[model samples]
Target: MTNSTWLKSADNRVKLLIFAFTILLLPFVALSFFTFPTTDDYCHTLTVNDMGYWAYQKHYWLTWSGRYIGTLISATQPLTYGSYFGYKVAPAILLLIYVHAFITFAKALSANKLPTWQTALLAFLMLFVFIAEMPSVAGYIYWYTGYYYTVADISTLYLLAYFFRHYPAITAQNIIVLSLGLILLIGMNEYTLVWLVILCGSLFFFKSIIDKKLHFKFLVLSLVALVFGVLSVTAPGNAARAESGLYPTPLKYNLLFSLKSSFTWEFHNLSKMAPALCVLTLVLIPIACILYTSRKPGEFGFFFVHPAFSLLVFAIALYLSYFPSYWSIAEPPNLRGQCVINFWTLIGWTFNVFVIIFWLLEKERIRPILSLGVLSWVVAFYFFSLYLSNFNYRSAWSDLLTGRAARYNKEMIARTELVLSTKEQQVTVPKLKNMPYTILNVTPDWDPAWASVEVNNGCAEWYFKKKFFYK
Candidate 1:
């Protein structure tokens, strides 16, 4: 075969692999949803299913839309197994929702100028937020409560992207639109809200000074958003929650401590994290190459010529995004919160990498060297993946991810049968073997023959609710 023909063939195969893997995503996620609830899952399920939603008793902004969204998922328990496909369809449905929403937003950002490959890479980046390969995949994207935040965040992103792209002068109609968008963004997470407020406001101020023109519309929007964020954070419910020691750490301490803890935690886990970093590096390197070749010279959007500013902004937002988690609690954030930080961290890391790449390309003297470096990166990434495939923990994590869905199918059946066939009103279920999908899982603590089955009936009762536990 000619060299060009051979290269084309390989490209086709790569595309095919991407397609098949994406197709595989649905069944994997669906299987997880089929399994029963884990630790906080049951509690959240009960609250959403049995109790009411949108109680001001819960934190107002934090829990408002999230409660409703989670309640929708919690309500799905009974039907999935008893009726239709149930939560088994969750992955695909969520994939389509998120992928479409993101791509649509991305198209708006690029003005539909980006190639399909780059767009697909963006979709893949979004997938990293979920998928078996990620840490706490089930918790962040599949659990009812976790999925609520995911949903809210997606909505927030969509709104922000749309509004930012279409930002205009203050007409009455535009004013309402801008105001509503700000409210929604602020409501998603106070930390993210604060981050954006500072990031966007600073950018606006700097741009105005540079351009010698004040943008009155964005200024008003920023002030209105500040008001919204303030009210949301200071809501009476926040004080009540803080009294429980949940929100005890003050904001000042949170910023300082979060910054300190992030470095400490990352440093401590450097060895353990190295392999995962390798995996991520491998995956991203090729995509970066593709991005470099496809986009024109200096076509980089925000990372244009001045990547230093972009890097600074990303670093600040990373700390701020992590601030709340570190601030309110002495301990580091649990897996759920960590997922958000990790996702942002990944974005920041990759963006910085691209910035370096851009810097190198901007220098005419190093084109040959840069091309050689790109080629080396791709080859090294392949070798790293090849090596990690056999490494103990990496292998285990991959195997666990692959085997989890099937395991869930088996356990759900056994648990269901055990609960259903009990002659007595109460019977304890055997403790379940742990699986990746079983985030925060706890099997019934019981003896082999006879254990107290306090939960024997609640399982059946909860079994009947509507359920789709994907973001």
Candidate 2:
């Protein structure tokens, strides 16, 4: 076959692979909207619903607390969930924002303008987040309450990339966008503040120290973000530490638990590709390569400094955030989750690798061995995402549905009526309250203004007033 024909055939296979990968990812992303909602989902929904009610009653700026957002949603009836009329629409809005951001990023990168191999590489990278099944079943995404922050940050990252492309030197518009991101980061999740700090600080240091282009705009913007980020934390919901001491063990025990969770590739029957370990491996690879080759310092200065410094700084910061000496996972109390921390680490690590690869490819230094290693990593990612995508803890709907008694209770909650049961027909409460979908546990005698229930030995027979949403 002609050389061009051979190249074209190879390109076709790569495209086909990309297509298959995209198709596989489409379902999980779509299904997430309908997948049995999580406990946090309900909590967030309650907050959303409450926000709408509050906003309608009072015209006030919506704080990070779902109070304002929920109140806003409640003003509009159509947005209500099936039974949980108060369920917030923030999740859906966030999902839509992510989609728009991704599309805008693709267009801005001119990803389609690249060569076939480059295009395929970009496509894979673009879908990398989904392939990883981020913040879904993963602890960092699921447990840490990072799902919202991650979604927002992903949008911010797209904006950053867009700014990077259009204006190499920061401009007013870039500053505004980035400042907004920093504000949003601080408002949404505290951990994201660290990420914003790293990005902005890196840009400052990289410009001043490495590139010697102390662009005033960049420096001023970073400083502004840092200042406002600090100020933003003053909000009631956004505090220094989460409610950490409440669940106090010694720092040592907490650290051990966090590290154990972080280090082990497996947790809760789900296997995660350990981002920290992967990073350690990638870091070792270049160090070994450098020692063996002993290439001049300047020859690979960008490769050595940019990624190693950036990733190491972030990883170390994250590790210290869960430190043995002073850190506690329980404090701030607003949201407690550390699950997707590693996913962010993995993202940082992946970018670290990308920078290295880009530098190597530019220098024509991607040797056959290096190329093979890269290809192997891609395959590993594919299988890893494929496996993680299917990992879910719950099975069977019957196990989750409210019993007949609970259904009857819900009907009363909706209609403000009472449930009647004769001596011959016992109308007892179901196990619905234990399920994740339930927002509030309403009893047969419970009032909307003041709700309370008592469960002895984990068994409660009170009739519920209404059906919960997202069941």
Each model's Cα RMSD: 6.9, 9.2
lDDT of 1 at 451: 18
Q: Any runs in candidate 2 off by more than 4 Å, and if so which?
A: 1-18, 29-113, 116-121, 125-147, 238-308, 320-340, 358-427, 432-471
What is the Å distance of residue 460 in model 2 from its true position?
14
**Best model number under lDDT:** 1
What would the per-residue lDDT of candidate 2 be over residues 1-471, giving only the tens digit for each residue?
Answer: 584465357677576656655553443333233322222333334444655655433432323332222223333332235443222233344445544564454444432333444434433444454434443332222221234445545655576556645553446877777776666554444455556666677667775777666767777767866775565445433222233333444543465565664434224212344542453344334433332253343333334445556666666545543332233442221212242354355445545564565455446676413223445566557555644543331211221233432443354353322222323233333233332222222234442212221222111122222332212
List TM-score per model, in order: 0.69, 0.58
Query: Which stretch of 10 consecutive residues in model 1 shows the poorest summed lDDT?
Result: 446-455
Model 1 per-residue lDDT at 457: 33
- Tens digits of lDDT, candidate 1, 192-220: 46665766576667657666898676677
Candidate 2 residue-wise lDDT at 343: 39
lDDT, residue 211, model 1? 60
What's the C-alpha lDDT at position 350 in model 2?
Answer: 46
**Candidate number of the best TM-score:** 1
